[model samples]
Target: MKCVAQAGLYEARIPTGAPYKLRIGWADGWEEGADPYSFPPLLSHHDLHLFAEGKHRELAHMMGAQTMTIDGVAGVRFAVWAPNAKSVSVVGDFNLWNARRHPMRLRHDGGIWELFIPNVMSGSRYKYDITGPDGARLPLHADPFALASEIPPATASVVASPLDFEWHDEEWMARRSSFHAENAPLSIYECHVGSWRRPDKDGTRILTWDELKETLIPYVVDLGFTHIELMPIMAHPFDGSWGYQPLGLFAPMPRQGNPQQLASFIDACHQAGLGVILDWVPAHFPNDLHGMARFDGTCLFEHQDPREGLHPDWHTLIYNVGRNEVRGFLIASALMWLTQYHVDGLRVDAVASMLYRDYSRPHNGWLPNYYGGRENLESVEFLRELNHAVAEYAPTALMIAEESTAWPGVTRSVDSGGLGFTYKWNMGWMHDTLSYISRDPLWRRYHHDNILFGLHYAFSEKFVLPLSHDEVVHGKGSLLSRMPGEGGTRYAGLRAYLAFMWGHPGKKLLFMGAELAQWEEWDPHGELAWNMLDTPWGRGMHALVRDLNRLHRTEPTLHQRDTHSDGFAWIIGNDTENSVFAWLRYGDDGKPVLVVCNMTPVPRIDYRIGVPLPGWWAERLNTDADDYGGGGTGNAGGRSTEQIVSHGYEQSCVLYLPPLSVLYLQHEGGAG
Candidate 1:
């Protein structure tokens, strides 16, 4: 196998005693040992350096040189990676989608399809016309590069840019930095910005960042959520995706606002004392022709085969991480959000898919690991490097993974055989809790183990009890919709469930309308049925939710950071009667705050539950409080010094238990 050395190639010498023959080129040729030409064509050392420099400059141009000065007007230099296309053109407000008027030049050196349109500055509407092989004309889309607006597919798109806003977030950014430094407990209010607010009437309304600053920020602050986890604000072409199919990683969705508007939104959240964490989807991208697909005359960033590049379940294109340029682009995107956007953190989406080669497995299409195993080692290495870069570039920015697999130590430090994510979504708890709550009351007892099972691995890599967007979408129904029993019983059960959620071990997250108990599943197009707030039931649920947030924040025992091994004590777990679950959250000073929840519908006359400590206790918060829209069976706020009675072999406290209620008991001086 003999071939002249070519640019962009590398060679290695074989050992003299090596017994292996050399195979080169496309497997059509072979040679005996010590054959110099047997080695693959190698790029000259100088050419390789030039190639590396060119690649670096290309990336720097995209990231650093924000406004590409052209014709005395600063516009962006747009580029897309599309190798399969024969020709590509830029069309937008300037060219009106005309292909011939704005044909992009091809850079054969890097195989990049590029165009530098003069006078087409930020806020210029655009799409691409990509002519694929066989004369198939496809409209190339917005480069995920610094785009300001997107049509959100199935909706009209307009021209917008990042330079169109007044931001006020310096103070907030400083405060957020301090908060992260202290490792403060984060309670995230995950929301979709568009659907978070809409016009009172129905003719297509979008809430400006100012509008959300005026309305949503105060509400979240009052609700006591320490952080706001926004659904992907990165520009995407589909509204139905809930912002998952990102077409532009650098630009916030134009429908919401320009880059400045988004900055203002984050600034507003910071001013309101809330940290912002973006939900980032690097797992796959939309296969919109107007986007990444073959924009550069090749499958430059993605795998060539549909089987290798496409996400079967999501119908999207997956990036080829093995490509150094592609990997650097993604890493750069992550850093861009942290450094430029000043985002407090990121929740990496669909990481399980990214970490696996045969994620949604097919019929023997994927390659095996080097050791003939069914693992994707390349993917794992990519994740490890990603985490390392994130930590190095943005120490304060938390990196969370939405990894549902049993991949061990996902949240552990990179040096410790882990992916080094700050936290991973506790999918186990979410599944168990949702399943248990959806069952009938009689059967609810049978599923009592659900809560306890979650606790078993509760401390495994810091977990977040995520009642996320997934639960509200895909026909899963709203949180309230999942409750069992009828009318008041159902309401009480829902209330008890919330109380239990907040009282559990791990941080908590509630999607957009869950705080108000919106009965309908999430609708991406409109507000959260604010009219529901006018109803008595709605008002009651709203107040209860608000109070829950207040309770979670005000009580040191309820704060996730405070309720660790020092504070957590499981007093009772009885599987026989399918009733009686009790746990205690204590203060740093060892003062106990007990929680006893009975899932039964009937009042228990003399329920005996063992107490972790022997002492007087006071009712702090109860789901059955009259103000909370529950029956008046709650004990008034005061201390109780009852003597401990014997139940079986354990010393216990017997109290009249309310059906479908959570009782919180704290030692007299335990309040923190």
Candidate 2:
């Protein structure tokens, strides 16, 4: 044994042969373990090269704490990338949280530190003890690629066993592509697992993944929703952020359960015919001490300059996507959800923040891009690369973008100089429609453009008309409460608006609780207002939503041509004074379906509207039906189109337009 430069530290030079445990005795105690230095490096030179090139598709397998059997000796191999760190060590329960017990060796090629700790089993909590270049010990950081983490309020990464999940989603996996096709019905029910249903009134307890599988899965299916889009379930420190600010990109949030339980829940969703989509936030990360902020006492994962790095609105650190390692890390996080957990899709959140350098920044607070433009060029490239990788790895998985801006070609192909998202949230449409629907019907004529403006760009990009959680939070009140009238009128208006949204030219996404017409805004601290269903108004609204989803899925004309302008045409779009709108929706293989909406409370008797053909038009749905809390004012079944010329069409239909309601009529292929 020889004394090293550090005091009270010694190195032993022993001939290497078969593996054996080494023991050291101190004045008060003793410790035993196989020397970490004695083991060969776990990552090969090629692995380091790929990581350096930012082309490593499976970095999760090489980085973070992974349980393995190295040279017939079972242990956990820990690895982290901190190029600027002077030294790094593994600190955890096995070593009594001592940084001096197991210092890691740095591989200079890729700036990765690794070490194999003998006899370290899975489920052991750990963190990295890093010393910056200035010789100052930085805060312990949770593993960037950790597959499992300790429940919040406890910051540590857990050594996870290799995934041994026996998946039973073969049927769903084999045909999910069809489910995501543009022509297929896409009705997404956006949900928050924590708030969907809680066991206690205080919201102190959270349900496990298995519990959600039993509750949420069947609930969504019964509601007729095609998919359940969960708000961020990634590991984040703050509960209020709603998983927006994630620290553990790879780890499943321990709040719900372990990673394996999550996989089982996803499996259950697939078996029940419900697709799962996770809200993925890669734009910024919170500055929690145990997270990736100021890692290695430097802006390692984020931009060094505040002008480029800090997100003004959120006060979060924006990732430095220009760095190869950071880009690779983010992409791997996305792939982990798709390939590892078997989620159907990822809805990238706050894409507007990532696409613009001046997002939510004051004139003097932001820096211009390299070309003197406001766009974030590096982030743009990173997004394109991420989409390409997802396409290559998980070809059938959807990559939706929650971008709020009018950025061109967001859903276009990347090879064609576009961002290449599968679908974009139609924020403009949502804003306009909500503004129009919220106004008093007496003054709605003045703002009629709000209702008609969305169609001008309806087919600009593959869109999803999202009535998301953003609309019902922070004192905005629930969707039901946003109407401009009292009592039954409010219920009628909400039903009309929902029907309008479902019939509009795009996919559909509604936040949880909207179906029941809850009056209170979303309370993240409590479960949804499910008790409201006991009320007549709530039950009526719930029934309407279920019927709407059923019709949207079964009627080809309602969903098949959602993305093509050729499938939609206006029959009476210029009737602002009457506050009435009419349109025709067509599918390749089905007869056209006519839709008419009356925003005012005054019913229009014998209202004339153009029709494409003379036929017995069967009424498919009426928002004014008594079952949906309306006055039951509607035509008997349906009306036959007369050969009277109107709105430049040879045929016309004289109909009883219900107050604050919308009607859907399908052509039955016979002239009256």
Candidate 3:
């Protein structure tokens, strides 16, 4: 780092790795302190090489305000990439936030500015006062790689180290690679910690990570879920955005607890046999002055052109993935969650917006790519590189994409020209199923195809059937409220729908409070109506979800071959007039699990349904049972198959299908 101290802009000579104070013609005569910039850059040569090549996977180590000791002087090393800035300075409370107190030395080769200021210890709040190319002072910006940030309403970057957590989940980490989720049952309970449960109804306080280990952990375990997918925990200013507009990618929200406590919470989950999947947002960021927007008085992280950079719906700026440094920065953020926090997976948010250049934009407001197409080629390439790096660094941690488009090969291997994700959220399935189930029961017959339509493309990619927060927020009603009925009928409908979703050919994800059939649409400020859990309908839905998850994990037929077409066979798919559907799910052992669903409030008694073998089918579960608050109308115990052939099968049975319910029956060895 060389400084310009003279009127002629001559570079001053300083001693090797020694601080030598030089007099600046414009400053007060005879500055006493040695020049901090005269020291060699702490950023490694390999880091610069990989960054220039657009492939540095760990940018957090080389950039930002990292705490380190250079030349036995305890201080923080500040580094930033501002290609267009004329000068950059480390301004903070230590120097009374004056812009000129600690001017940084620029590395002309890579446009990086760096300085090692001694005695700047942890807990110091800081910012960068950048002199733009036009020599104008821009708004002071927070450190992009700040390990921690000041609590919201106070937007200063705190000097902290992220590696302070001592992990104790080596057993979970060692065996994670063996559990390839696609081959195993993955029933995720997606939850927002702040709103999931509050200390009281007044929304007085949020449950901390320590508090959660005792409550949220055991609750999910008792419900028999395999994993917990948390809403974004990254530090963000606006609470209404639901952590989607994150500013601190590296820091866990201190409001929840310190970074290490968040780590301990994740460790607790792993120790309790539950995997943790974090919702990660790398697509866009809010235009808050202290965040990434206009850093160094230029479009440093975002694109220079609004048409190519701005997100119309989110009112945020999109990351310019074309920039090598930006790509590395985002990839490193994803890695931090896995490597540092021991997270099991990531649910990438708004991937469709990242993949398309014209997403949510009018024709006049968007720009075409280099090939004059809607595809964002740079983002596509960046995604490939990101996935590649994740595989190399965190081999067991899954990368799941929330892509809503009919993109050709989202989960395919990148080697074969694909984006390389482990699984993709089945948005099409969620939409079509919800639409069909919301219709009046009498008119449901007309739209029976809506429930079965997603199966046509189900196997195109590994899918997760998510009844997520997005479907219950904004103007959309809660899951139970979406059903077109009142009182017991709606509860019955939701139970039947949950059965269908569980038996569907994919992994499962259910948002919190959905199992309780919460009536209020999701509100960020309120805790879930926990009092509902004591009601009959609430208890019934809860019981049903518990059984669903338990059964899903125990029965190999429900998950073993989930990603293939062979596991499923329709027995009553085309019975639209009756609004009834039946199917058989099979495992490797050739045994079949029979499932029947009645969408209408009309029971079909003594109805003949085909069976592959001549055996007794025991009624394993009936959503219409009295314990579940239904009329308890179902086949008593079991039914033996008759000699009569029906529905193109060798054997058949006359059975009862309860109104607005689903039944799971297991074959009892050849009717003995």
Candidate 4:
């Protein structure tokens, strides 16, 4: 029991046995002076309400919810405010995987089930077994109030209460202000923790966050990615659903690690000079009863009606953002992660669903916004408020949207007729690129417009070129699979496409395995076929991606904020033949970079390519280089710029462009 005073505020500590009111300085800097001891309980409560009227929205939401207590034992002493359910048992790991052995006692006040299982240690797992009104046996259920973790069915998980890890990220944490101000180019490497690493043999061995920190951190840093956009780490009840069906918004999945372990992983990333952006799913949650569906005797946090509550395609329950308490709960949850875990950014998942009331639904099943559109007014308001609060509280943190619709002003400031996000995924680019690449090499000419068409929207809200987790999953296959040919040609084609991706106007993001040209669909159970790293093709692709990262960092033309009309220009060639496509990228200093790509499978003969300047241009990078598993059809190392010439048309030049290869030419400023 000690006391001290600082900045006109009195701080006092009391023994654990005493019942005392802990007072802190109010937001208005009010002091509890003089007769603080003589204040009556009722009068003090009234005064507290006066103090709370404008400043305690987050605390107010917490007050209406059921109270929970964690006994000193390693496990939690949970008692939901639910006044229903005929029977309930703490049925997780503490009960030896039996649902019936440890039934909870029904308290007198309501139908609340109470239980304290001492054996349910921290890092030990458990769930509830609730028997409903008509004798329906609900198996071990996810906890609505869980601040830690949940398990996927058919695969049991343990509860890891937080860990205490040593962190060395104080410097990164302090630089938050400058980090956001400069608008540094955000090159994100999006990854799914589960699928990113699993047992090589696959007998249900999961790689923990600790393992990822040790194994994946160095690889990512070596790859030169500035950030890692983690696919949802929030606790969920299904392995097949990815982390999108979130059951615990405030807690990292225990299946991966304890909260502290997850924090350590993030800290490790920061130490390696990488930002972490979490994929946050706020659109809907799983319908599992043990989750937020029907706790506290009703659909407390979700919409009551099916039309408003259900996401038909996802088969999940939508949150009622219209309710003040629910809105506060969600906003508070977002703030909690930012504050507690020090996450640098959040990629709001499925934002298109949240924006439209009729998203994936029939006309009669939807509501309209104030403008008489399918836009959900409440959701819009919630998002606006969320962004505003994020800016106010965590100004350094970036908010990105996985929004596909042309939801006007999504990345604009909320007060300036916009949604106030830092960036929005260039979903159009992803679709167009995939569609174009999936076709045969000969047919690429017909679809060539898709690539340029994507550039028209490149200026839309600070875009990020995302070949994200979505592309590899759901039967789309890996990037290598989407290429036109087989063997070394396919590998070369993939390298060409990746080079194009890196040199594009926007920020870049690739899934974990894409750097290595992972042949199979991504699996959540094991490490990226690490064994493939020894192969020549895999190593070549990996090296190319690493070099691309270096190129992005070293070249100012590839940065985000430098986009201008003159910064990029496409050089027209034989459009009908679709034989070649060329473009120039210029930095602010007028240093030009010429890029020419031939989509044809056969070697292009005497292909005349028009460059922007007549000066001698050196081939900086070529996909046809022997080092990248190409046909060695390009200039051998230093012989690239030997007497290259130009005609008119913006200082145009001609060259023999190679087939299925991309060439980068940098102006060397003299006839060789």
Best by TM-score: 2
Q: Identify the runs in model 3 with alpha carbons over 4 angstroms from their true place.
A: 1-38
lDDT value, residue 361 of candidate 3: 91
Q: What's the lDDT for candidate 3?
A: 0.87
Instruction: After the best TM-score superposition of candidate 1, give how far the Cα of residue 477 lies from its true spot, in angstroms.
Output: 2.1
> What is the descending TM-score order?
2, 3, 1, 4
Greater-lDDT candidate between 3 and 4: 3
Model 2 per-residue lDDT tens digits across residues 20-84:
66788868898787777778898999999999988998977889988888778899999999999
Which runs of model 1 end up more than 4 angstroms from their true locations? 1-119, 126-141, 150-167, 181-183, 363-365, 560-566, 638-652, 669-672
**Residue lDDT tens for model 4, 468-547:** 88888778788898887878878878888888887777778898898887888776655576766888888888888888
- Quote the lDDT for 54 in model 2: 88
Task: Encode model 1's per-residue lDDT on 357-466: one tens digit a residue.
Answer: 78897758665668877666767777888888878877778888998988888988899989988888899899998887788877766777887787777766677789
Cα displacement (Å) at residue 498, model 2: 0.3
lDDT (0 to 1) per candidate: 0.70, 0.92, 0.87, 0.70
Decide which is better by TM-score, 3 or 4. Answer: 3
Instruction: Give per-model TM-scores.
Output: 0.83, 0.98, 0.94, 0.80
**Per-prediction RMSD in angstroms?**
12.0, 1.4, 3.5, 10.2
Q: In model 4, which regions exceed 4 Å deviation?
A: 1-145, 154-166, 176-183, 560-566, 636-650
Clashing pairs in model 4?
92-126, 92-127, 93-126, 123-159, 195-524, 197-526, 198-525, 198-526, 198-527, 611-653
Please report how far candidate 1 places residue 286 from its true position, in Å: 2.0
